[model samples]
Target: MYVCPEGHMAYKKARSLQKNSIKNEKLIFFFDVEKCKCCPLEGICHKIGTKSKTYTLTIKSNLHQEQLDFENSDAFREKSRMRYRIEQKNSELKNRYGLKKSMSNGLFGMTIQSASTVFIANMRKIIREIEKKGA
Candidate 1:
């Protein structure tokens, strides 16, 4: 079972459970993003256009009403800190690698360009790691 960031239900068993006779994986959905656009609690429980838009969810384990505690939880805050890193990496790839704007015109050319960009990025990361180690 994989916990989606949107707190949506997901139930894909691991390879070890392939031979098992289990029918349903029973994935639970939990989250506090009920004020966001996709949330059903928006406009009813909370006011519109709030500055502190807190979007969070948990699906691996069931927390019931305890999910509210995550609002002020240290672990949650730390996890949210990773949002910037992810956004930064996405922007870097999109800008430097031209991920969204492919130079290739056809399918084959696009595939080659994508592969080459990934390879180049990986190589750069490896070189940076080696340089760091030497330093």
Candidate 2:
């Protein structure tokens, strides 16, 4: 939530959430700009003639600002990109390959079930790659 300079409680226009890093994070909140038109502090809040007015509030504590700064670095984006790809594969395993539940009851049964499920999934991927290469 945000408050205008004139003391009006602002309504959100949009919100963005970041993956938390050692901090309780509410990444960004965009205040509704339409309400700004009639606001007494409109001129102070934004330029006199612009159609768009945006105000953002980020809820991470100052103590974690260093972590936020690191998230903006190139290394973080690269790591996030790699994580996204693997997460997709993990999702496919659970959803399409039935890796979400064990087919058998005991530990050995669970292990073999898991191994065979992964093996089948890998074989399908290998076949697809070979097909693509041959084509």
Candidate 3:
């Protein structure tokens, strides 16, 4: 079971199907049209008279749905808070360490530049830790 991003209850999983020359079959999930009709936020939730009553999600494998389900669990919610700290680190690298734009042209030069930037960032973190410890 998957809930929509807007918190709508999507209760059923439809079968997988491949329509054309697509390589992978798509996994579909659905919400009852009757529920949508009765919902107070119907206009905001879904457009009235839409042809389809289902929400379609494409999955790479059976494990993909399982992964999504795990992500929705309470334990995952607790762990996901750390993602914001990681994002802040990335933002610092881009803004403070000048990783937002490549200084060198060509793939090899870009690789070198990125490596150097990351090394410098790591060194800065080490220096800060040492300073904090006063040793």
Candidate 4:
């Protein structure tokens, strides 16, 4: 979609590697210099002494905006209220349970360790709640 100020259409020149980005490449485009070397719009598009016109198209991250309606909504507030308690529980699991590092190898071992840790934590919570109600 790149066009020079003189209404000349740009064509694909090369696929240039972006130094910082791993997944994206730059599509370099060039305008026909024969039609633009002496173009009156030279200063507007490029420097007046430049030989040819070239540009790269990059989609800015701002173009992919998040849903603003979901940010300050009721559901958002509800989750925000639970975030602290959930994070505290995760910290407890990591410190008290051997969740900071896997005690064994492979997916099966990790699953067993996680299941046991969560089961014990939930059981303790249920016992505490029952004792509180009984008191």
Point to the candidate with the largest TM-score.
Answer: 4
Which stretches of model 2 miss by more than 4 angstroms? 1-39, 42-63, 104-113, 130-135
lDDT of 3 by residue, 32-92 (tens): 7777777777777678987556776665666766888898999999988888998998899
Worst ten-residue run, lDDT, model 2? 21-30
Every model: Cα RMSD to truth: 16.3, 9.7, 8.2, 8.2
What is the alpha-carbon lDDT of model 4 when measured against the actual structure? 0.78
User: How well does each candidate superpose onto the true structure, as a TM-score?
Assistant: 0.35, 0.44, 0.45, 0.46
Model 4, C-alpha of 65: deviation from truth (Å): 0.7
Among all candidates shown, the one with the greatest lDDT: 3
After superposition, candidate 3 runs with Cα above 4 Å error: 1-18, 21-64, 126-135
Error of 3 at 113 (Å): 1.5
Q: How well does candidate 4 score on lDDT at residue 30?
A: 83
Clash-forming residue pairs, model 3: none
lDDT, each prediction: 0.61, 0.77, 0.80, 0.78
lDDT of 4 by residue, 41-130 (tens): 767777766676789875334323244566658998999899999999999999987689999999999999999999998999999999
Winner on TM-score between 1 and 2 is 2
Pick by lDDT: 2 or 3, better one = 3
